[model samples]
Target chain A: MSNDIIDGILEAIRLLFTFDRELWGIIEVSFRVSLTSTFLAALVALPIGSFIGLREFRGKKTLSNLINTFMGFPPVVMGLIIYLLLSRSGPLGSLGLLYSTSAMIFAQFFLAVPIITGTAKAAIESVDPTLKETILSLGASERQLWWELIKDSKKSIIAGFLVAFGQAISEVGAVMIVGGNIRWETRTFTTSIVLNTRMGEFGMAIALGVLLISIAFIVNYGLTRLQARGG
Target chain B: MNLLKVSNLYKEYYKEDKSSINVLSGINFSINKGECFVIIGPNGSGKTTLLRILGLLEPPTKGQILYYNEDLCNISRYKKVQYRRKFSFVRQKPIVRNTSVFNNIAYGLRVRGMKWEEYINDVNDIIKLVDLKGLEKKNARSLSGGEMQRVAIAMNFVFSPDLYLLDEVSANLDPMNVKLLDDFITKIKQDKEKTIIMSTHDPLEAIKFGDRIAVLNNGQITQLGTPNEIFTAPKDEFTALFVGYENILSGTAEMDLKSGLTIIKINNLTIVASEQVEGEVKVCIRPESIGISKNPPSNVSYRNNFKGNIEDIRDLGNTCHLIINCQSERFLATITKLSLNNLELAINSEIFINFKATDVKIL
Candidate 1:
């Protein structure tokens, strides 16, 4: 058993260092879906976040609380919702997104938007009100003021984006249920890991696991650097 | 011509628990074109609120502010922005943009649609004017409080808005920075086409800079007059103290038929005032107004004079406040440090405190 473990570790190293094609494919797919979905989510999230942060309106607190609550939603639940929506015979079935890369992206979007929005809101809200007043005093239009505020909070917003990306790329259950983990089409780092391990391809599984952790590390490191710079 | 008019302006702030604070109440004032108007008040006297309303940053709770005959208070936010661009409100503690000093100062002009080539020289000139020439590339947020304040002023000054609204810009600055700011203010004052309205808690600033001054206290305009008038004759108790009248004594008065003066009996001491009020009233005398002498200066008939023992001496930097006890009635008299040294006065020293009857303000 001990020898088997050591052999598996060595095999994992070889697979990673040799840039195994199948393993890289899994990585590319995982990152592609995560990057695209997170970028799209950011476009939708940032404005919502800033609006919620800056504007005073009825139901504002309730909306903020709902965003916060959604940040902690179970990944599998999100996957289930996307699966049901995109499944044949469901309301959104006509678009035929079920069991596809887009379906996985839809699930990931649901997972990432809340995290990004929640974090962006917190970051934007931390901005000094005096800065807003000063901007306004400079005769900034409303859009100009919001733009300045977002620029003021760019570092934290970027940190939040990185965190959301980390969460999206590491997510497995949602992508699995929605994408059906197709070999060449929808398989990702995490889904590939589960499949490779279950099928006794320990090297591929461990390689994907290592790459996943490296990505997570890079994201957290960026966050740490941002914080250290007092951003 | 009147450039701006604030009519019966009112502002209220509601708290989380539903309690509200009336920040400004029935504030009425107007600024003549090319005039320097100063609002003098202690901290939290609604100076900022009133300035904000005038800046078009806030709408008065129940009033109208007309800018060149246009009611700014009731105008839409878009319209207010258009009008607000005509003015810049420099805050007490300037919150600078998180950028370079040059960028911060250039922000106003940039927003005004000036291209970089059009505004760089102007920005550089202001940076030089503010004595922040070499620090143009430095991050404004990283600067000291004084430097950030200069940035705030420079940004506004460079924009050359039709009106400049400064909210206690010099209150917390060091002497060096204060001089720099004062020089900038004087420079701005040189431009006759630009009107400026500034607020300060310092009476001296009001006296030095204001063509006219308004005293605000507890959400109301206590008095409005030229600085000389506000200082020499504060209208009410609040205005009196606010204008640096340290000695406030409540007493009853009657027309003294023989002296032909209203004599206020404060704690068994008869103090004569020029005002003809003949009932309970408060007598306010600026400490500086009370002349202190080592001995009773000759013609005692013309002045209200009292021989007192110095109870305590408060050596406040440039001037000294002597708490004098005259026949058990305490009076505060301020004298220059030079006099304090020259007279060789100390605690328990015997001295005479005197002021003319006209110097006593009856409130």
Candidate 2:
């Protein structure tokens, strides 16, 4: 068993060096879907999060509780919801998004939005209340206050964006049901790992696993460094 | 018209469960233009609440705040913004933006649509005014606490707001910073026709800077007058204690109608006050004005002098409070700790306490 594990590791390293076109296709698809979904989610979440953070209103606690609950949503449950929504007989069937890259993007967007919104709200809320009061007392308009909050919390907002991106890129279940693990198109690194392992291609599976981990490490390291330096 | 008149202002803070706490109850006062009014009070006396309401940062629950003959309670939101910019609030915990010192001071002007050149001249003058030269480009957060407070004042005062509302602006400041602020405020008062209203717990600061003094206690203004008036004649027991009237000796007053004087005899100790206050009087003597000596001074004409033994010696750094036990009375004399050490006074040593008759106020 030890020899088998050593041989598998050696083969994975060799495959990593070889840079197979099929593996590159999986990586490209993952990047394309994850980037699109993260951008779209951040675009929608940041303003809404800041709006929610700066205002006190009725039902605010309920809204915050619901958003927090969504943060811990089960990946498989999210997959099931997307599958039901995009299937042939589903409500969104007429759009023909089922088993497509766009369907995978939509699933990833759903997975990422709650994380982005929750973190962004916490970041904006963490800024000093006196800073807000000082700005208002200095005659800042409503629009100016919004922009000032975003400026003041730029580092934490970027941290929120990176967190959402990480969650999107690493998510498996939602992407699986929606992408269908198509060989050349929808096969992300995680989806390819499952597909290749089931087909008894252990070498490719382990190679994709290593690559997935390396990507996650690089992204997290970059973000954390940015955060520490107050970018 | 008074620059600001508050009639029965009240503020109630409600908790998340909707139960209310009354922070300010029916606070009322008025300040005329260019008057430096000081509010002296203890902690939690609603001084900050009154300042907030006057600055238009917090709305009063039930009353009218009229500024310049305009009822601020009914002002429209847009007009409120315009009016708020005309009043500046500088807090003790200086709230500066996490930006360069120059930017922090220029923020008000920048918000008011001033050009960069206009900001340049104005910021320079303010930095000069606050004596914060060579720190124009430094991050405000990196500055010392005193420097941060100076920048906050410069920021607020740069716009020449008609009213400068300082909320304990000298609290916890070092002596050097306190002196700097005192000089800066004095200069502001000298140059600008701005009305300055500040709250301070330090009686010395109030006595030094205030043109008019208001004593606030338990959310109510107990007395408002000149510093001398408040010091010479505090309305109530609390005000008297707050204004450094530490010695409150109760005794029976024997009025000498022929000489227009009242003599109080407590135990075997007799102290004469110049005023003809009738029976059942309490004589208040300020500790600073009382003298302490190991031996009695030569034939001084001051009518209030007591020979006693030192009961206790409290060395409070700058000053020492010596509790003296007279034959039938007790008195406190606040002398410098240096004087106590130089005199080599001990707790059980005999001493003489002397003050002029004019310094003793019989209430």
Candidate 3:
């Protein structure tokens, strides 16, 4: 067993260095879906999160609790919910988006929104109250106040986005159920690893796993550098 | 003409349990342009709340604040922002942006859309004024507390607003920074176009900086007058103790037909005051006004003199506070370090305490 594992690792390294087209194609599909979902999710989540964080209104606590509950939502459960929504004879089925990249993006966007919103809300809430009063006393307009808050909490906001991106890129259960792991269309690093392992292609699975970890490390390192520079 | 008038101002905070706490009530005062008004109060006295209301950051629960005859409480949000631009407020704790010191100081100007070229000279001048010249490029969050306060002051000073509201801006500052802030405020006080309203618990600061002082206690303004009047004649017992009057005694007074002085007798000591009052009264005498000497002078004009034993001596850094016990009555006398040493005063030593009749205030 040890000798087999060593052979599989050596083959994975060789395949990675040789720029295997199928492997890179799977990586591209994974990034395209995750990045699209993360970007769209941020656009919707950031403003709502900041508003909920800064303002006190009726039922705010209940809304905040609901968002926090959704942060821990299971990926497979979410996939099932999206699958029903996009399936034929369902309410949203007229769009015919099932088993496609868009369906996978939709599932991942749902998975990432609550995570981003919850983290961003916490980040904005952590800003010093004195800073808010000081800005207001300086006669900050509504637009200027919002701009200052965003600038002040930019590091945490970026960290929130990175967290959502990490969750989206590594998620497999939802995409597998929603996208059906279609060849060359919705095949991602996570789903391909499972598929290759099931087919006894240990070398390919190991290569995908190593590539996934490397991508996570690179993204996290870049974001950490950005946060440090901001500080 | 009054620049700002606050009438019947009141503020109450409600808790989650539906209980209400009255923080300030029935507050009424007006400030003139180019005058420095100081509010001296103890902790939890709603000084900051009052300052916030005047700064237009918080609205009173029930009252109206008029600025040049315009009701501020009824102004639109846009107009409120515009009115706030005419004044600057420095909070108790220095709050700076997590950016360069120069950018933090230039935030007010930048928010108003002033070009960098237009404010660069002014910002640099204020940087020098607050003694933050070398740290302009440093991150503001990395500075010490005093340095951060200087940055906060410089930020407000650069705006040169018509009214400046400060809330205990010198609370935690070191002596050097305190003097720097005092000097900056003194220079601003000389500018006739500017008005200032500040709050402090320090009586010396109130006396040194205020053209008019308001004594606030328990959410009420007990007395409002010039610094000399507040110091010389506090209206109540709380104000008397707050203003550093050490000897507060209840006595009965009657006019002396011969000398035209009110003679107050308290605990076997007869006190002659310049004021003419009858019946029961409270008298206050400042510690510094009493003269302490080793030997009684022969030809001096001091009227109130008593021979007492020095019960205690407190060293107050450049001044000595000597407690004299005269026939069961204790009087505190503050003398300079020079006088303290020249007289060789010590505990249990005999001393003569003297003060003029005019120094004793009958309240």
| Number of the predicted model whose TM-score against the real structure is largest | 1
Candidate 3 local lDDT, A1-231, one digit each (tens): 787678789989988999998888898999999999999999999988987887778999999999999988899999999999999987999999999999999999988899889878887788888898788777687667767888899888888899899889999889999999988888998999899888878888899999889889988997889777846
Question: CAPRI band of model 3?
Answer: medium
Candidate 2 steric clashes: 0
Tens-digit lDDT string for candidate 1 (A18-123)? 9888878888899899999999999999998888888788998899999999999999999988888888988999999998889988888888899889988998
TM-score list, all predictions: 0.79, 0.77, 0.78
lDDT by residue for model 1 over B27-64, one digit each (tens)?
99988887889998888999998998888776778998
Per-prediction interface RMSD in Å: 1.0, 1.9, 1.1
Error of 2 at A76 (Å): 3.0
* lDDT of model 1 at position B68: 85
In candidate 1, which residue ranges exceed 4 Å CA deviation?
A1-4, B245-363
lDDT string for model 2 (B49-118, tens) is 8888888777888899888889998887678888878888888787778789999999888888889987
Q: Identify the superior model by TM-score, candidate 2 or candidate 3.
A: 3
lDDT for B1 (candidate 3): 85
Ranking of all candidate structures by their TM-score, best first? 1, 3, 2
Instruction: Assess the local accuracy of residue A21 in candidate 2 as a C-alpha lDDT between 0 and 100.
Output: 84
Candidate 2's C-alpha runs over 4 A off are A1-7, A88-91, B14-19, B69-80, B191-193, B245-363
- Local distance difference test values of all predictions, in order: 0.86, 0.83, 0.88
